[model samples]
Target: MKAKPAKESLTIMNELVLPNDTNPLNNLMGGRLLHMMDIAAGIAAQKHSNRVVVTASVDNVSFKNPIGLGDVVTINAQVTRAFSTSMEVRMDVWGENIPNGTRFKSNEAYYTFVAVDQTGRPIPVPEVIAETEDEKKFYDGALRRRQLRLILAGKMKPDEATELKALFLSEE
Candidate 1:
């Protein structure tokens, strides 16, 4: 793919976390955090494709730290690639203590979404252009993540997926 001028991809959702969005332990619920992630991803897809987007699959979502109530939880999302009708979005979550001004990484995940027309049918999406080294690295990582997604969707066998994973992860 030809590199295009580096553009801003991250769409940060600010102030989405609230007091009632917590669990019994007073931490932000995983489900709630997931919902916010999805929203941030949709916004990124929409910005990239300029079309209505719907979530197709969430590849991997792992919580790294607890998100406490009243913290400013930021959901940062970006479009890593786009096919004819689908795009991959990678997201990271961070929690900030409003009072102490401390920020901590909370979680991260990657999701796929399909761009749709007004009729709710799949449509063409824009090309993915990776400019800087960081953007290129992000795109390459997204490819491996997509392979895992194909395995999860039953389109690829476990052995093949494992092989692809090994090759993709070899550089690391």
Candidate 2:
């Protein structure tokens, strides 16, 4: 498969927080934000793979700020790296109060997705080539993050995570 530039998969999605999307405190609900993030990340993964994709895993998501009911939520997603049939997508979310002209980062998360065919079987996807320094950094760190994810899910043994081990190993 041909390799694709990471920027080609960039996806930006926006949503206006409403009464039904918020909690009693008039803040956007976490689940609602996560839903939007998933959609943004899914679109990015599909753009990178050119195939239907399914969410494989979601990394730790921390809510850094509460989005008010009238805030506009923006989610920026991009494919950071591709590994075989799966790719990692990084999503940054921000909430802006247009009236107040204030914006704050709501959260950031890494979501893993696997390309699938008609039968829902995993299919190979194109590799991602980093073109910017930030993209390069995310691409390089993806392996370590994947290893940790696998370890936490019991899909990979600790000893088999060479990339993660290298981080703590010293060269004599």
Candidate 3:
């Protein structure tokens, strides 16, 4: 299959953080934000793969800023890279308070998704082309990140992570 540009899988989702979605401190709950991110990332992965996709793993998600209640939450997701049957999606979340005209980055995360067939088996997905500088940076970093993930999951031996080894051993 022909490789698709990373932008082709870009997805943007917005949500209004209401009281129900907030915690006792009135900030948007972490779980709620994660749920939204997962949906947005899943959509991006599906767009890239052109097949049903399921969440395989979620990398560490760090909440940088608090999203207050009534704030507008915007999530931008894009497929950073595609492996044999899986894709890595990068998501950046922002919180906007329209009344005060303030906007801040709230969270960022990486999610892995596997394309699936009718029988729920993994299916091959199209590769991703990095056209822009930022895309190229993320695309190049994906392999190192994937190697670390596999190592942590016990799926790959540490010695076999050539990308990660190169990254750590390279003299800047």
Q: Specify the highest-lDDT model's number.
A: 2
Q: Which runs of model 2 end up more than 4 angstroms from their true locations? A: none
TM-score: the better of candidates 1 and 2? 2
Instruction: Write model 2 residue lDDT over 1-172, tens digit each, in one string.
Output: 9999999999999999999999999999999998999999999999999999999999999999999998999999999999999999999999999999999999999999999999999999999999999999999999999999999999999999999999999999
The lDDT of model 1 is 0.81
C-alpha lDDT of residue 77 in model 1: 88
Worst 10 residues of 2 by lDDT: 29-38
Candidates arranged by lDDT, highest first: 2, 3, 1
Candidate 3: which stretches are off by over 4 Å? 170-172
Please, what is the TM-score per model?
0.86, 0.98, 0.98
Q: 1-85, model 3: which lDDT tens digit per residue?
A: 9999999999999999999999999999999999999999999999999999999999999899999999999999999999999
**Residues 1-172, model 1: lDDT tens digits:** 3322225556989864567899888899998888888899999988887788999998667889998877888888888877678888888889999799799999888889998988999988877888778778888777667777888789888677764658747564
Candidate rank order under TM-score? 2, 3, 1
lDDT of 3: 0.97
Error of 2 at 150 (Å): 0.5
